[model samples]
Structure formats: C-alpha cells, structure tokens
Target: MTYHHTQYLEDGSIASTLADLARAHRILELEGHGDMSMGHLSYRDPFGRGLWLKRGNLALSEVVDDDFILIDFDGNVLEGTGLRHIEWPLHAEILRARPDVNFVGHSHSHFATVLASSTEELLPYNNHGIWFAYEGVPRFADTCHIITTVPLGVDAAKTLGNAQALFLANHGIAFVGSTVAEVTLTGIFLEKAARFQVDLKSSGFTPILPDPEEAKEKFDRIYPPKAQHNFWTFFNRRLDRVEALQGIGISQISLPSAV
Candidate 1:
C-alpha cells in the first residue's frame, strides 16, 4: 500500500471537497458491487495542473487518502508511494486530448464486461443509456491491451474524441466526465443501463432506441452537474466516517505496500 497522496488535500484549499470526490468513486466502486482493487476513478486538478487517480487493484473498502496517486499531466507519478497503475497512459492520453474532460472512470463492471466479450455496441434502449453520451458511443474494436504503451493509448484516445463513454471491445468500459462526481454517477448509470440491457435481452423485447431530439433532451438532465455533486456529497460523508474509524492518518497511509 504505497500511498502517494498522504495529506488528502495538498493545501488547506479544497480539502473537504477534494477528499469527498476521491472517496466517492472509491466507495461507488465498492458499493456498486464491482470486484475490489481492480477498477478506478480519476480527476484532473482544476485551479492547478497534475491529476488525482486511484492506484489500481487496491481494496476499495480500504481506500485511504494515501491510495490516491497524484500525477502530472504527462503521466509522471508526481506523488505517492505506490507505482502508478500499469494503464496510467490511458488516463494521461485521454485527458491531454480532451481538455474539456475533468474526470475519467473505468471499471470491469459485470454488465459492461459482457459487451466487451462480444462484438456489439452497448446501444441505448432509452434515455438512460444516452444520458451520458449525447452522440452515441464509440466502440474501439482494435486489439490493444493494458494501455501500457504510450502511443497505443494515444491512438485509442484519438479514436475516442468527445464521446462520453467508450466500450472497449474485448476489454472494459471508459467514462468521461466534467467532474469526479459526474463520472462516478456515470459509472453507476452505465452499470444500470448495462443491467437493463442484459435484462431486456433476457425478456426478448427489442429495445426501441430513443429519438435524437429525445436523447439529447434526456442526456442534459439525468445526473446533471448539481445532482452529481449532491449525490457525491452524501456518499463521501459516509466514506469519511469509515476512514475516520480506520484511523487513516498520513503516517499510516503515506507508506507504500506491495499493492
């Protein structure tokens, strides 16, 4: 457990806000019931440079301020005890190409994983699926792995462009957001959409794609910015309580472990 972000907030500035956002995604990755220590949530530092991201494959239930790895925009491990996620390139690659993006969340969520196992787009059955991506999703069918190599991740990022979500075929899910809270909610809704897709497939009713106008209308409202922040606000307070109970102090969290 090499914890890079020991203080939770670098300065007293945005301390509570930053910790809440960090803890929100980690908690969702835990409560959304995904496999722990595998998925992650990340956000670019606004009012500054560098990024705050999860050190991959750590137990979500055990996530502390130290588990958050702060890195430069260029993917340097700016601070933290543990090595960055092997897929760090993807985070930098996407953020560099899309400045409008504030956060990116990825997970090997169950329903989305099924699509990764197939050769199909996770199309919208209604407004819920389209709420994140105004202009339908872009599925990268290429054969790449881990985003370990720099150029490989860049090319994939180029293919992504402005889409809110990209279903990486034979891989996993990528969600872009205007904030950590937005992306976190996107992950929740994405999994919900996925579960609905799976259930509909089981029910044998053809999904009626929403009209373009309707899709645009819905995307703007469902989990809007304020609502996203509000949900994160509530969720992270619960997490902070847990963090307090565990006594996740800088001394305990700052040291690195096997990870």
Candidate 2:
C-alpha cells in the first residue's frame, strides 16, 4: 500500500486517516458491502475544510488513498482529482449534526438492504445484533431515493440521532463513528445483525431475544475500545491474506464459464 504524496496526503495524519478509510472500503467490500461503485465512505477533515470522501466511479474494493477528493459541505471539490459522489451531503450533514463523529459510511449491503425493505426490526439474536440493541437501529423512512440534497441529508441525520447506524428505507444503511475502525465495524456488524434476523425469519422459527438490560451489559463488557481495536486488527489481517492470494494470481471471485 504505497501512498502517493498528494496535497492532502502530504500531511502525515491526513494520509494515515485516508489510508484507514481506504482499507475500510476494502474491508467492507469483503464483508458484503460492495454494490458496484455506488457505496462510499468519508473522513471529516481535521483542518475543518470538509470531508475527504472516496471519489465516484470506483468500487469499494478498488478505493486507494489517491481515490479521495476533499469536498466541502456545499459540494465543492476543494482538493484531489475525480468526481465527488452526489451523496456528499449524506456525509456533510451527518458531520455537521454529530460533533462527536469523524467517520461516515454508506453501503447497500445485501442483508441490510433486505431488512430495510421490510418492516422487521433488528433483534439481538446474535452478538452482532447486540451492538445496536441499546440505542436501537432506526430506519430513515423520509425517502428511499438517493440523498443528494442538504435537506435530505439533514433529515437522514435527524433520523440517525445518536445511534451508530441507520437503515435507509428500501435503500441502504448509514453508519457513523469517531474513528475509522468504529465506523467500519458498525457497517460490518449491522449487516451481520440484519442477516441474522432475516435468516431467522426464513427459518420459520421464533427468535428468543435477550433481555434489554442483559444485552446492554453484554455489549458493554464485550465491545470495549480494546475489543474494537482487536476486531479492526483481525479484519486488516484478513484483508492481507486476501490481497496476498490476489498477488499470487488467485481471483477473488469465481464463476462457471458460459457455454
């Protein structure tokens, strides 16, 4: 992962942040967040310029540090090359609303999108589901269309409130956190939790959810800051193995050849 020194990447901290953002893109892609080139991730500029977003026209798996463009709240690309995602406001207004958040990610993960289209709430049937059990995952029902306007973004942010993640009705999911690891993990776990509920429904078996107090207690004991760091480290190592296999000429995917 050689980072080319660009105007934004010249700053060590900014470079490292974007590097993490890029890695997060790939990590989420591996964890079932890929939807062609539609999804995106962003980092709030430390200097207060705006959010440094993953540029458009690239899939999550293909995002490198150089693929970012620094865009202000008004959709102005202040730095870097490539076109900015029209959903820039999705990141902008969230950062504006949540002073504590520094990272934002949006993706149409499979199970999450399925759960979003349905009225079913995410249950704490698994460890992954417990992360959002206390705050409760809220659905942004204002619109299922792309969040391209400031007002729409603001509405989405309002729906998000202080929760770590939001399900966009019939669309995707939005997740925010104070760091890249937390944001990325939110995206990953949200998808996993959604999958659990969706699959449990498909199994035709009633799910026995944990008590709310017990779930919150487990979340506190298991999801400490150190656990988040450890999970991030594990994902990075997993990514390393995948990339190493690709380096050896193994394809990340395989399909039967057409007749």
lDDT of the structure predicted as candidate 1: 0.65
Per-residue alpha-carbon lDDT of model 1 for 157-177, expressed as tens digits? 887888877777767777887
Residues 73-188, model 2: lDDT tens digits: 78899999998899999999999999999999999988888888878888788999998978888999877798999999999999999999998999999998898889999999
Those runs of model 1 whose alpha carbons end farther than 4 Å from true positions after fitting are 1-17, 31-33, 47-49, 221-223, 234-259
TM-scores of the candidates are: 0.78, 0.91
- Pairs clashing in candidate 1? 1-257, 2-256, 2-257, 4-80, 37-57
Angstrom error of the Cα, residue 38, model 1: value is 1.6
Residue 244, model 2: Cα distance from true site in angstroms? 0.7
Clashes of 1: 5
**Error in Å for residue 99 of model 1:** 0.7
Error of 1 at 39 (Å): 1.8
Please report, in order, the local distance difference test score of every candidate based on alpha carbons: 0.65, 0.86
Name model 2 segments beyond 4 Å from true.
1-12, 247-259
